[model samples]
Target: MAKQYSRPSHYEQLMKKLQNDFPGSEPITGLMLIYLKHIVHVVETSSDMIVKIVEDLHNMEQEETSCVAKSKILIISHDIHTRLYQQWSSRTLDIVEHGIEAFDTNETFENLIVDLLTQLLKLAVFLMKQPKLNLKNAMDALHEKVPDLLPQQSVVHYLLEENDSSMSTPSEFLTLYQRPFDTSLESDMVWPIPTRLFPYN
Candidate 1:
């Protein structure tokens, strides 16, 4: 009978490998991975819905398609956006609740808080970069994501700028992600309407 080799313990293997990695590499890498994974989850979930809605819209607009089908495909982006926001929010909270202070960063805890905000900014950029969603719709969705910084004037700001122009989305909104207490934003917030008969801003 051939002698079988015993497997090394995971902790032992990790300890052996840590010598090559930086002091905090494991935890930092783990946290970064978690953050990136959450981002991918949100994007994947949102994009999947966006792609389906766009496909439906395209099918409805086809020459042989019926009017009923066209109506069904319209503005489904809002629903997708709403659900995406909810997912991002919940995941963000979970991250915070799970020993958020344990991460080792060069900056103080306050700065780490800022880093969390930047993650939201990255997510917003990712959402807008999705080609299936129009600029107007992207702006609308972003407004929902960052209500405080964007406020009521956000859509107008988004509209006033050229579609190709790059604007940095705010990070402040991410601080509220996944919190235990319910936010009071709902009562005070109001999304602006075009208010014109022709729908021109």
Candidate 2:
């Protein structure tokens, strides 16, 4: 399950809670795409940990707490053996920075959410297959020397700031709800993904 992306601050709290609740050593690992107000999350963990996380997220939303968020989850692939990632981390890319232009076309937020998740998953697998290439961060790879790493007219558009060193810009910083990104993205193998974003999927 995932929570609807909340304010950067709230998401920050959520990230912190996730880190603290599930330590680095825990078997849980997945990706989080903070797309504007929606969070497309893929959690690869044990069944028990999954339940605990869902319950914790529910309490966070219903308890009138500092962070108000909820998740309507899609089970990408379950009862799997390998984990795609070594640790749990998030990438906050509001590609459509304001969450406005993506809807300028005739598409529901749900559609955009699926598009992002599908795109990112494919991109992850592509990166994994690259020989002698260590593309640790997708956002960083966007601006790096590898033109072949990404396709032209990318749907996942990330605009870096003028000053490369500055992590203050909101648009460039998907790291915080506020840095360009907090952590890089990584994955190991491909897996079957759910097309729908609902639990029914």
Which candidate tops TM-score?
Answer: 2
lDDT (10s digit) by residue, model 2, range 127-176: 45555345455534442433343222223222110122312222222223
TM per prediction: 0.19, 0.48
Worst 10 residues of 2 by lDDT: 158-167
Alpha-carbon runs more than 4 Å astray in model 2: 1-26, 97-120, 130-133, 139-201
**For candidate 1, lDDT tens digit of each residue in 13-56?**
43334434434332211111122112211222333333432343
Q: Candidate 1, residue 98: CA error in Å?
A: 17
lDDT for each candidate structure: 0.30, 0.47
